[model samples]
Target chain A: MTSRRQLLKSAVLGGGAGVVAATALGSLGPEAAFGAAAPDVEPGAPDPDFAEGRIRSIKDNTLLVLGSNMVFHNIRVVDGTSLWKLGPTTFDQAKPGDGLYARGVRMPDGVLAAESVWLNIVNIKGHVSNITSEKIHLDHKGQEVLCHRVAGKSIAVYSDAPPSADLSLLRVGQHVQILGAWRPDTNEVDIATVFSPH
Target chain B: MARSQPTDPPIDLQAAVRGEVSWFCCGTAWGPCSSTGKGACGTCNSGNLQHAWPNTSDACWAITRPDSCGFALSRRTCGFQHRITALCSGTSVVTSIADCGPQTDLFCGERSCCGATCATDRIIDLTPAAYSRIASLSTGLRPCEISTP
Candidate 1:
């Protein structure tokens, strides 16, 4: 019998899905696991298959979370789980008080069998207040948010164009929306994708 | 529980307004959103196709002056409908005003773009249900164009 540790190692090494399927854990198919699509429900209704909250504790592979609705949730993380912090990362990087949005299947016992977890991810709509070689200053709701650029990792999408790595088009005072990893306990974020409509 | 929809007041046809759009949770409390309360309308919910307009009231206008961003916004009461389109996806969702929000003046002159189409300032705040219909919840913000339905 393959141990859970071995299964995790294989899953991480083998690149995410085939091993989980072969091991009889549900298939994390392309459409379901990677699309990051939310369930079809009324606009303001809480999604049954989604959970958003802060991590209260971590026991082995299960995460104890206190949701925005004051509900308790147990999220079971596995090898197939795509954990993202500032960028693509591993599960061990998740810690207490880290905010998250998890999408997955809910088991019979109400445990969410997570497929993807985005940790401390925040999308900010702001104007470029200033720019330095290493960081972009964003004026968000009168607050200054220092956004750092990750070399070779940060990307941009300019008005209907495909995402590219060129950051030169970003002009000071341009309104931009940034998808980034929030540096907890601080006002900093590492840019992952920056979208400029113009 | 069954709920009655409020009758909408007559809308004055106007040109589409452009700006940044964001989401805020109301109704049932959750995490850092607990302080948001049930919104100014008292009927706000995260799961409804509702939104917050900066010009809902004089008090609200004091807090969210869109003019500070060089945009003039007309005042509309709760339950008035506005058709909002996401610049990124061109996805549209018609939502009614449920509360006052988005503090436009705070981030005056902010802009967002999708291509040749770009929007400036913070003009509206949508409920999770309304926003998620056009953009993902995790994204928190999007560039948008708003108009009367």
Candidate 2:
């Protein structure tokens, strides 16, 4: 298991300016806005195919997964979400080989150092409250929150929650319902049927 | 035979959580919705609402109902690699992720403010001038590395 303290220490000591965060768990502030100051163009656009992989190993907060393309990926799942069934509070209960999808800085070291990694989750929902580079920060039930997306981004299943409801019609103030798996460490929330009022 | 609340269903909360049931999704692995913040985006400041965040290393916990800290789910979006570095001294302006050859330490030019302009591993920090170049972006060249007290 990776201690948050070790992860923090290594972020500064292990190398120069190289931060390998597992998901969005860093006290570090925002990365100077790429487009905030300068005009931006879509360079390697955020591919919906943010790669899917299986957990190959766990090093501290780092998770090395075997990407579908045969590439080994090191990731960090943010420990938070908008769904309840996904999980909460810890990463110990998670299993490797489960699918994952995420985006962040990729290191030449073949480690896909993540800002956030989504796990296989679903049928959970919530409202967005704020935005920052550090986290897709949320306010679930008044507690500081984080989101760990699961099993790629498209929330795609249902057995409980509202079956006839689609997760698309949701707005910030609008109420929502969700379902899926969750892990507490990477605070990433995965949704399968984000429901909302039309 | 026991009766249930009119507003609440007669299902076991625990069973519903553990049961393999329906699941909506955000699409992309780490679904980025109105999805992010430094530390303030939940149900901590609203009224008439039940906030929902993902479950962490353990079980899913709910937020206070009627807190106001979340935004609309659809109106949030960004596609840049926001990063953190320790190489700032008096010079380098650092930006998103830079790959250091398989575990080798590295740096991106002094605040390569834009991700497109940066050459991965192009700028480094080990000398005085290097620090000055970086510090120039936010603050004038740092005289020397300050140690945290």
Candidate 3:
């Protein structure tokens, strides 16, 4: 089977490189790829490396974010920093109250020199209340959410197993988690992935 | 249970603790996020049974700084299994630590209440696959219990 990892590689690095990588690491399971051990850092310290949270304030190009843990982050967006919302976007589009996840080189002064910032990305836990070739209907916390599947983009993983491009594994009343781009101010989302334990 | 796999173990309920959970995505469908590709763990996909925890490594812990908020999370490495249960519906899903996230320190005192149930402290962030398994992506945050299986 064409594992989701291979499909992701192909999507990001092109088919040739993806195939090469797939062959090079064929014996390993997907989890094995993330199992490498790394050195430890100080306890209770700000990553000085990455940041995620709500935008508390924005002044000039700097964003003061309050993280979910109550930690504050000063994220500085440079020309090289990439921003995304429903799709690729610019920093000017960011607003207070927007949620963001940033990855960057932490400056000695403690500001996150953001390399990339994603806005309003959400992962929801819901049940596959309904499904069709084009969309999946979900009941999340008693609210209805419409998830549209993009061709060649959305995929699924079953019960900690390797991910596949198949959505056939999905069924009504089946619990699932969907990771996707949230369309701001709507009850809808673009499904990027679906996870089910089948 | 429709497409049941007999090989998979049963979901465990004994390992539960209440906290707040949210969701995030990589390999986006449009715009700049689309370039996010995978994640810190190259294998992270929105559709996979994955999640981001406050403490996945020394480096990750330093970043999330859950200690600043008085939550001491153990250093769990990538691919560690965690089962999150949504308090609103009691629905649950098992996910692996795919990356670091939901900076516990930022929302230290924050609480999410659903009916009579309320949870505080952002302890975990789920991939869409994991998050959608128990709650709505639109709700953004939910009260949940996390336990090992």
Each candidate's number of clashing pairs is 14, 125, 40
lDDT of 2 by residue, A44-117 (tens): 12222133455767767667776544666666543321111243224554466555544443344544433333
DockQ of candidate 3 relative to the true structure: 0.05
lDDT of 1 by residue, A69-174 (tens): 6788898787667677866678899999887777665666787766667687766667899999889999875778899899988888675466798888999998
**Candidate 1 stretches greater than 4 Å from native:** A1-43, A68-70, B1-149
lDDT per model vs. reference:
0.70, 0.29, 0.64
Q: What is the lDDT, from 0 to 100, of the residue B128 in candidate 1? A: 62
| Rank list by TM-score | 1, 3, 2
Q: Which candidate, 1 or 2, would have the higher TM-score against the true structure?
A: 1
Provide per-model DockQ scores: 0.14, 0.03, 0.05
User: lDDT (0-100) at residue B34 of candidate 3?
Assistant: 41
> In model 3, where do residues sit more than 4 Å from their true spots?
A1-198, B1-15
- Displacement of residue A66 (Cα, Å) in model 1 is 2.4
Model no. 1, DockQ: 0.14
lDDT of 1 at B9: 30
